[model samples]
Target: MLKEFRDFIAKGNVLDMAIGVVMASAFTSIVNSMVSDIIMPFVEAALGSTDFTSIVVKVAGITFRIGNFMQAVFTFLIISIVLFFVMKAVASLKNRFTHEEEEEEEEVDPTEALLTEIRDLLREEKQSASK
Candidate 1:
């Protein structure tokens, strides 16, 4: 069990996943800051001081903060857009740094290789015979 665990860690998939998780966590903080600090202020200004969360109608004495819901929706949208652009930039940089390696030659089947050799030998024999 110890050996199996060691092998699993050695495979590097876990390490890659850890790195990805860390990067995502860091990216999330940045997006959250942008949404709360940068974008939300503009949205608030556009929306004005009229608190949407307070404007509610009671159907069966049920209170619904529509303004709060709208705020949540806008926050989600801004975060999504910011993350999208960040991911796009990351992809562009990754593409720029990591070039597409030349494809390796496909492995010829052993039987096919043998048959090719036989065909070449027969062609040579036929050529010699014709001469």
Candidate 2:
């Protein structure tokens, strides 16, 4: 129904997901530009090739662009590393803000507790006898 559809659209998770998708697309473009424009040039210079994508291999009449594949893999690695760090930082900040860390409680052995109580009782009895 219309009401159900409207409710689904109005959900906070749905809205967050929509925004995340938009942001991710924008971020992807920025990363792609950085790889192709900035990083690739340096890599190409080191390899002594101006156009790395143009590098190819021909075998049995089949041409394979190994350069393009390498570039794609490099770009993917950069994006993955960047996203990993970003997500780690975000998670740390979220944890810091959202919850107080639980202090670890030391476990007391029942035997030790019983011994402590007996020691206290003995100390009290000695005091009473001394009085």
Q: How close is candidate 1 to the true structure, as a TM-score?
A: 0.58
Segments in model 1 whose C-alpha atoms lie over 4 Å from true places = 49-57, 93-131
Local distance difference test values of all predictions, in order: 0.78, 0.81
lDDT of 1 by residue, 1-131 (tens): 99999999878889999899999899778888887788778877986742456656566888777778876676677788887888899999888666543122355679999999999999999999999
RMSD of 1: 7.4
List TM-scores for all candidates, in order.
0.58, 0.55
Worst 10 residues of 2 by lDDT: 98-107
lDDT of 1 at 51: 42
23-126: candidate 2 lDDT, tens digit per residue: 98998888778767876677778867645487799999999999899767766776787678778999999887655443223556799999999999999999
Best-fitting candidate, measured by TM-score?
A: 1
Q: Which ten-residue region of model 1 has the weakest summed lDDT?
A: 98-107
Candidate 1 contains a number of clashing pairs equal to 0
